[model samples]
Target: MFRLAAAAACALALGLAAAPAPTSAAERLTLTSQYGPGKPQTLLWERFAEILERERPGAYDINIVTNGALGGEKEEAEAIRLGAITGAESTIANLTTWVPLGAVLDLPFVFQDAAHIERVLEGPLGDELKAAYRAEGFETPAFIIFGARHLLGKTPLTEPGDVDGLTMRVLQSDLHVALWRSLGANPTALPITEAYTALSNGVVDAMDMTKSGFEALKLYEVAPVLTETAHIWAVGVVYFDANFWAGLDADERALFQKASEEAAAYFNEIAAEEQEAALQRAMALGASRAAVDQELWRAAVAPFVEDFVRNMEDPRAVDALEMIQEAR
Candidate 1:
């Protein structure tokens, strides 16, 4: 869905495309990713860059850094706040530290399906969350999704009790920890950069992440069983450094905002295709796919979801969750 020409179609060939070259005489800015070249998010960054190139010629040189070279999403976000880095994407769970309103998005089973997610996030509720993001020093221009997360392990983990006693690698979010803890897994908060070695060396028994993330990092090579939990929708923001945004002129900010909208919409349009393709690749590589019992999972997590909303430090999170459910 990108405007790149036929010859540039390789950009979406799953791991074949690199970010386009930086524009000429443009102010250098970093757009970091926890993935390498050819991944969808990397391509999202490339798409963002191309829009800037066409609309604000010679105004920005959005340098793409992949493979957690700038550390994980949390580090990248910290750097952005310090103005040490320009931008990166982060899940709503990861943003909970600064914006408790993110809790609404992280609730399990809140999103019924991809269409439900698109309707809620692309509608008024999303705009409210973006304003919350801005209040916390994150200039979120686009809401991108990383697909739903599933468990990856050496054996099928298709039920709530199946995860008992398993060591799972999770992002550095307390909510994520609580989610796993409630399911009886000992969750380790690790930066994604170490997931491969951790899983390879048996430091962890399994992990949960989006299929594209597992495929992009080749994590399926180590954890060959993917359980389709679809518990969380995994929405995130393609955000800018608040400090950088503060310095840009109104016209400049408008240009970049427009580009973010277009690129993110394109990203959403292709998210499913990318996930399905990534799952196929993982399966072809001798990985096993398992299905979760939907009723079982829903019942198991319903109480926690309720408690989570009730205890949210930011009262706005409850309102946001209500808005999402009402929209659904």
Candidate 2:
């Protein structure tokens, strides 16, 4: 019996030795964003990956692709839908193509401030948006503010009337087109990739973007005039591939969610500060800056906002709009 037991132990040891060794690190997953390295959008995910790896070492490996290495924003969104990629930092405006109800968030003058945005998005309205995104097979775990969008124009845009007859580069989103048309501007739809050339060649006299966006794209070099329209507070939606998310165990998923939220909060606090600094730097670099009558701009766009909410298909849009307007 002792010899038999020793033989069994030897057999077990040999079998264990023959088996493949366990991997020390997890397989890497991809995270794609249009923003290239050193951009704030990419920096958010950089921080997220760092936190995730530090907290759950060897459990998750994230390979981040910036500068639209995988594809443009719309293409990346489709990849997420098809499970071709793990996740993307998509603009809320571009996401409208998949989830049309998301356009409500792009409505001009909808949000009061970052605090107001947080309150509405973290509460019932946010819940509804999440459900809407999930219905379309995507999930947004967190939202990062880009900053209040302003007008960057070769000509000064100090008031709503200044936009009249000007050719402006608007986002490809439907709502953006409609908003600019309502303001009496000849809206030209252009991708960010083509915006610099269009601005330089005088194809478009004006364009709207946040301070960071202007700095990232170096638009101020061409447009030269920064008008603080604060028309809309642009936000980046953190979208995860639903199938990829479902494949993860509960613990792994929780780590992702926690990291996203923590990274979002960290960036949110500094977004405003960065916007201010970006504007200062642009001015120092020879760009002119001016402030518009925000009240007049809001009033000019009020009709469009009212019509947008009234025409929304989602029953939640009404409540969401109300909730945002009423948020302190």
Q: Pick by lDDT: which candidate is best?
A: 1
Residue pairs whose backbone atoms clash in candidate 2: none
Q: What C-alpha RMSD separates each model from the true structure?
A: 7.5, 11.8
lDDT of 1 by residue, 25-45 (tens): 668777877777877777788
lDDT of each: 0.82, 0.79
- Clash number for every model? 1, 0
In the predicted model 1, the residue pairs found to clash are 35-67
lDDT of 2 at 4: 46
Residue 26 lDDT in model 1? 66
lDDT of 2 by residue, 174-223 (tens): 88888888889999987777788999998999999989778877899999
Q: Which ten residues in a row have the lowest lDDT in candidate 2?
A: 10-19
Candidate 2: deviation at residue 284, Å?
1.4
